[model samples]
Target chain A: MSSVAVIDYGMGNLHSIAKALQHADSSVAVRISADADVILAADRVVFPGVGAMRDCMQALNETGLAETIKTVAASKPLLGICLGMQAMLSDSEEGGITRCLNLFDGHVKRFAEGLADTEGNRLKIPHMGWNQVHYKPHPLWFNIPQDSRFYFVHSYYAAPDDAEVTVATSNYPQAFSCALAKNNIFAVQFHPEKSQTVGLQLLQNFLHWDGAL
Target chain B: MSLAKRIIPCLDVDNGRVVKGVKFVDIRDAGDPVEIARRYDREGADEITFLDITATHHNRDTMAHVVEQVAGEVFIPLTVGGGIRTLEDIRRMLNAGADKVGINSAAVFNPEFVRQAAEKFGSQCIVVAIDAKKVSAEGEKNRWEIFTHGGRKATGINAVEWAVRMQNYGAGEILLTSMDRDGTKSGFDLLLTRAISEAVSIPVIASGGVGNLEHLAEGIISGKADAVLAASIFHFAEYSIAQAKQYMQARGIEVRL
Candidate 1:
């Protein structure tokens, strides 16, 4: 039986993600584990997190899962969700610019304060709610339609130095990279577990993906 | 593109079953809470709010089970409220698969609970539900007052001021409900809804008195609410969530269509 490990680094809604994965494909075995052995042995790895970058990095560093994640990223298909996506970058501006995993060449940035649309109405921070995701050809976007709506709830977003890694973009008044992909790694700023139908399709795609670029 | 204005269908669960009533009285059984939630999700509900009206310790486990079941089938965000008093309670709900936990009476009685919950589990998962009623007592200017205990007890706190306080205390969103307009279906308390929405920077979900799709649109255009929550209209299948989204989309409001 195929097994997928959802890394639990003392952050994120591990239960919700695990349940969503099982629901996405009932045959796949989904396990929420922090142990390195469990993660390495699984056919795929999903890194999911939320909250401040400082605490996220703190928990990851303290638990030594940082090294385990990097080790697994080299061979297996790895998917990062929300903060997990941001953490894959070099650093973040949150909490006085904390450094991140640096798996991909990028930086996480906070949405500029006082941002507004053309109508001059101030946009709320956290960018909470559904926004359309425009994607390029990729395995994760296999069956999902173009410009599909996904749920997003974050104040900061990933800005990769190399635009080649960007797989999808979304507009929060301005376009930002919502999904990034390089070789075996795939990451998204939106919450697929909370994104309904299209999201489940993406998760299902990830389950069958072979970690190819 | 702008953030879509959300239309949330709320399920008032009592002992694991969905129930609806007028002004929180003469309650009638609607259906299974999880099944109703699943239906709303498929029909294009922006989100779902589950309020445990019974609020008893004995039924807490049952509520969690319902949340687990709903969370498994429904992919949209779920906010569970009622009888949430402590941080542990919030943690329990989130662990049980709820995306967000809505605190009402506990937050009014002890404002610090809001701060602590926000601090512990990011504000995104912490929603403060305020049940407010307009006070037009002699010599006092018209002001909405906060009510607790399922809108039975009144607190002298000003609704708008309390909303601001909750935002300042690190609440990510405010679920503002008008007690007077709740079951009346006359229309939302636009005055009260607008007051709280304008008072806080965080997202405000206007609740109560939604009789039709136009009322939902008014909640966004007139009340300035980021989202609108309704129970009866949806519970009885009077109007599907897709119809409401189509109505709002026609009115130039961005909805997930």
Candidate 2:
């Protein structure tokens, strides 16, 4: 039986992701594990988290899961969500400066203090709520309609150095890269677990994908 | 299209059942919280807020159960509000699958608690719910103050100032409810909504007194709310979420249709 492991590094809740994975494909054995072996042994790994980059890096490095994540990224079909996606980047500007896994060459940045649309109204930070994700052809977009709206709640966004790695983008007044793909890895700033039907479809696609282009 | 303005349906849950109390009183049964949440999801609601209005200590767990059941099937952002007092409470709700937990009276009693909650859980999950009532005399310059105990007692805290304070204290978003217009169905207090929304950089969810689709649009256009929340207009089948979205879309409000 195929099994999927959701990395639990003492950051963010694993309940939603685990449940969503199981809900996506009931046949897949889904487990939330903090142990390295459990994740390495699984067919797929889903890395997810929330909160400050400093704190997340603190927990990950302290638990030595940072190394585990780095190792897994080299060998498995890994998926990252929200802060997990940010963590995949080289570093972040949050909390002065915090180095990340560096699996992806990029920096996570904070939305500027005063972001306004054409109407001159100040756009709220955290970029909370649903926004449309425009995607190009990719395995993860298997069944999700192009430009489908997904739930998002974050203060920072991934800005990959290599634009070719970006597969999808979303606009919070200005376009920002929201999804990326690079051999054996896929990551998103939006929460697929909380994005309704299209989200589940993406997860299903991830589950069936074998890390091939 | 840009980010769609969210249309959230507030489900006041009491002991596992969905109920809507007019202005926080005159409680009446709506239906199962899970069922109502599912219907809202199917109808294309941007997100769902389950306000646990349950009073008894023993019955509080019912809200978690409701969230757990809904979270498994309904794959949209679910926010649980009402009676969230501590870090443990926030953790419990998050563990049960709530994307966000709303803090109300506890914030007014101890402002620092908001900071602690945000620090521990991250501001993204810490939503400070503000219940504001207009206190100024009709002829006088407009002023609103915080009210606790279901909007009964005035706290003398200025509403707009409180919103900015909470945001500074690390609240990710503000759920602003106009006490005067809550159940009156008159409409949102555009002035109050605009004041608090403009004061804070965090997203403000304009809630209370949503009688029709136009009111929803007004909340975004005039009130400047990042999102608009309503209850009875949806709970009683007065209008579906799709209908509300269409109305907002027609008015060029940018809904996820």
Candidate 3:
């Protein structure tokens, strides 16, 4: 069995994430251990959450999983999700200014002005429900569609400093980064786990990633 | 870019089991609500609304345990309606892992319930449900009146005005059901649906009278609804959300397939 470790840092929605990985035929183990060896030895590590950015980062710091996560991300495949994805950015505007995991070079911010003056395009905030994701040119674009819908439930989104890292984009008010990929690290603004077959395929692709350069 | 439309699946629960009937009679076991919910979650359902038909008569709060179980298994957003009358009801639903709460009779009796719940939980968490019947007359001009208590009482309030009032009261969305067309399997009331959709700035979910995938697509396009919700077609496995979405995408509607 291919052992996949899903880091549970006092965040919600771990069960569904684990179930999704298992559905993709990967053996998932929910882990909160600060022990470096356990994380370092896993085939892949998934960081998942469904809560405030500050509380998640706090849990990571308190459990000392922060160092374990950093160490593992440098050497192995590490995936951050939702708040976990936001935590990968440099910082967030949620709950005042706070430091994030800094796995990537970016800051997360709230949607501006809540009013997009586009004709017939009035939408609510939180950007809840399914939206189309447009893939940028990258190795991660192997089997994903050019225009596919993914589930999104976020109030703030990633604003990466380096444009080159963005692997896919989606338009809410205007186009924004939906997924980022740089070396062994990748994150999506949308929840692939909840995105059904297309999402399952993404997970399968991640599990079978050859890291071909 | 045009705002993408939503496709939602509604499950009607009676005494913890999903029951199906025509014209709201001769109820039979449809399926387990949790199983059906998980299937819809896998079928790429945009969002889910669970309506507990017996909630008021049973004298219970909203079905929190079911919400908890479904939330544990499914990661998508869940909205629970039925017997939601107070702020505590909204809080309970949210605590049970529901992302949004739907209001009907409570909002009809007291519009302040809409304002209060929206204030307590944020406007995005509140959904005002309206059951409407068309008033047919030349001067009536495609008007719809709101119905309450399982479509038993006619409020005589114009559905469009109520939609506008709910929008002003901080409702994030509206679930409009056509009482006349419900369970008839004809198709959604597009004229009445369009009127409510046009009157409100918030997202509108068109419910009732969806018999096939084309109805779902047409509901979104013709009715100008953000989402088209159906019960029988989905409950009886006549069509899946994926199939409906594919049909919509084929018809040039931007659906997340």
Candidate 4:
């Protein structure tokens, strides 16, 4: 059976993603491992995280998983989730200019304070709850429909330098990059494990995707 | 489209089973938290909240199991409230696959606990549940006070001010429950909801006293809450999560269909 390694650098939803992946496909074995060699040996890689960007980077660097992630991003089918997605960017403004993995050409920015919707209701920060994703064609999206709502809980969003790299966008007060795709790597700012049926479907798609353009 | 206001079906769990009676006539067991959670998830619930009212230490273990089971298959965000007093407690719930944990009385007793939990676990997972009651005279400037122990004890802290304090302390969201109207089935105290919602920069989930579908809509339009949480109305089959979303959509509020 094929297997995937969920890089566990001691931050974010480790057990949840592993279980969701197995639930998404029983044929695939999901392992949450920090060992660089064990992770690189897997068929695919899933980098998931929650919490602040700074602490996440600290753990990844200290555990030597940061180098492991860069190697995987360039070599195989890789999925980055939430803070994991943010860390793929060049740098994040969170915790005062924390350097990310720089896997993608983008910068993470915090949502401006006192933002409101068309109805003028003050939009809250951290952007918690469900939001619709307007996605472009990608193998990862598969059967997930356009404008499908996904769960989001973050204070900052990715601002990719190249518009072509952004595969999906969601609105808080303005359109922002919520999903990105490049050769061998697919990243999302939403939690597919926590997104219910459509989320599971996305995981299944990733399990089957061969990372070809 | 923009972010949709969330409609969450809250379950009061005790000893691992749903405390409140559920009216799912076709489901095998109405009291099973996992079953009810699955039902709600299928009905398009934006999120599911389990208000663990279990008091005994051993029974709390059962709730953890319940969360684990639900988190494995249910997929949507799950928040466990009640008796989450320590970092260890928060860690246990998160390890069990809970997306977040709600802190209530513990936040009132030691405000520092909220700060510590936020730092240790991240504010995104630390939800400060504020139970508030109207304390001012009918004609005077409206003011509400925080209550604890299921609204039986007053903390003498102002609700709006406390919301700001929690936000400053790094609470990601405020699960504000209006104790005055919790079970009244009348409606949410819109005054209380808007006050705290505006005071805090984080998301506010308006809870308590949701009698009908319109009350849920009212929560967003009038209360300015980012989300609405209800127990009896959803628990008793008064409305399904899909129907509530449609109602909010009709009222021109964005909701997941």
Off by over 4 Å in 3: A1-12, A32-44, A51-75, A93-99, A112-119, A136-143, A207-213, B1-4, B21-48, B56-79, B83-147, B153-173, B178-181, B184-202, B211-215, B236-243
DockQ of each: 0.71, 0.88, 0.21, 0.87
> Higher TM-score: candidate 3 or 4?
4
Q: How well is candidate 2 docked (DockQ)?
A: 0.88
TM-score of chain A of each: 0.98, 0.98, 0.92, 0.98
Best by TM-score: 4
| lDDT of model 4, residue A174 | 86
- Every candidate's lDDT: 0.89, 0.90, 0.78, 0.91
Per-residue lDDT tens digits of candidate 4, residues B55-140? 56887788889999998888888899989888888998899989899998999999999999999889899889999999999899
Candidate 3, TM-score of its B chain? 0.92
Highest-scoring model, DockQ: 2
Models 1 onward score TM values of: 0.95, 0.97, 0.73, 0.99
Q: Report model 4's chain A TM-score.
A: 0.98
Which stretches of candidate 4 lie above 4 Å from their native place?
Answer: none
Candidate 3, residues B112-179, lDDT tens digits: the string is 98998876666667889999988667775577899887788888998899999998998888899999
Considering every candidate listed, which one attains the maximal lDDT? 4
Tens digit per residue, CA lDDT, model 2, A1-213 = 899999998788889988999999999999999999999999999999988999999989999999999888999899999999999999999999899999999999999889898888898898988899999789889978889999899999999999999999999888999999999999999999988888999999999999988
Summarize candidate 1's per-residue lDDT along B1-257 as a digit string, tens digits: 65788999999888997776322112233467766776788789989999998889978889998998888788889999989998888888999899999989889889999999988898889899999998877587769999886678888898889999998898889999999998989889998888887777678899999999899999988988889999999887778899989999999899998
**What DockQ was computed for model 4?**
0.87
